[model samples]
Target: MTKTVLVTGGNRGIGLAIAKGLIANDRRVIIGARDLASGMEAAETIGAEAVELDVSDRQSIQRCAEYIGPVDILVNNAGVLYDRRVLQNPGDFDVSMATMVHGPFYLIQQFEDHMRKNNFGRIVNMSSEWGSFSEGLLGPNAYGIAKAALNAMTKALSAQLPNNVKINSACPGWVRTGMGGFTAPRSPEEGADTPIWLATLPDDGPTGGFFRDREPLGW
Candidate 1:
């Protein structure tokens, strides 16, 4: 059976790569983006449906959920990175957190019931290695903090999910994207591998884990 998959921020970057990967596997994919034109164009390219979704906006998320309906796989790949330091301007921190953490958290809560009822689901939260407090790397304060919170949210949701449902976080590493900039080592295709792996995991796969390149990574 073709699984229903939804990838947020699918118009570009890692999200777009993941969408293409799923499409190649013949999954029923939907590309969600903040821009309708870009989203539709991406969807057309990947043979997927397009839905308008701005992770920071609750109304947009609601509309996308209503349009896509229940999906077998949900990829929370939308994120924002603030280049400023914590002391630079604390207000920007809230904005980053709202998009990176709160947005995905609320969407997970909203779609969780559908997963529960279906008794089968896969949720892959896009996280970052910079979020690893254990690693002691703290450049982008807002981005790091938000991704750490996102990882925690993934763990919490995994615990609440039924045996048939699985939720995990994937760290795409330093990929060359608009957010990652041109200096990053990995390509979007390489960055997307871990997310696609987690999304298409078997029923027996691990949950509540943080991974990169299909291998568990330090939180």
Candidate 2:
């Protein structure tokens, strides 16, 4: 049987590419977008389903869970990196954490039971090397902090998840997407590669680890 996968922020950018790649690989994909219209449009183009999902909103998350009814794979690929950092716009910190950290946490929680029941699941939390403390947390202050927290959550949750339901964090690198900007060296297809790989990991695949291009990286 084909597994069902949900990619948040799947209307565009890295998320969109990931959705497409998975579909090509024969997984049943559901594209989650904050905007229903654009998400449906994207889904049509890719021959997948689309749902209105604002990761920061618990109601939206629950609604998505109800609609999809038991996602075998989840890609917490939704995130925000406002030009304004916490220092520049302190409120932006809340927005950043809500979308990147808190949102994914709740998403995992919402799907935990369903995934557990199936005894098979895959979760890939999109992260960034910019969030790497080993690298000195050199990215935009808020984005860096938010991603670090996400990495922490990935490790913490792995301990509680079923062995068959693996969760791992992935840094897609600098992909040329709306978030990465036009000058970025990597293409969307290239950026989606790692997340796609992690989502389809075999039973022996590693979990609770941070990786880039399929290689382990310091968190």
Query: Top model by TM-score, which number?
Result: 2
lDDT of 1 at 8: 89
Superposition error at 135 for model 2 (Å)? 1.6
lDDT of 2 by residue, 1-219 (tens): 899999999999999999999999999999999999999999999899999999999899989898888889999999888766478798889888999999998888888787899889999999999999887887797899999999999999899998999999999999998899999999999999999999999999998899999999898
Q: Where does model 2 exceed 4 Å of error?
A: none
Give candidate 1 misplaced runs (Cα > 4 Å): 137-139
Q: Candidate 2: TM-score?
A: 0.98
TM-score, every prediction: 0.95, 0.98
Q: What is candidate 1's local distance difference test score?
A: 0.87
Q: Give the per-residue lDDT of model 1 (tens digit) for 1-219.
A: 678998989999999999999998889999989998999998898788989899888888888888888888989998888787777889778878878888887788778787888878898999988888767646387888888888888888777788678999998889999999999999999999999999988888999999987988888
Pairs that collide in candidate 2 are none
Number of the top-ranking candidate, with lDDT as the measure: 2
Q: Return the lDDT, model 1, position 67.
A: 84
Give every collision pair in model 1: none
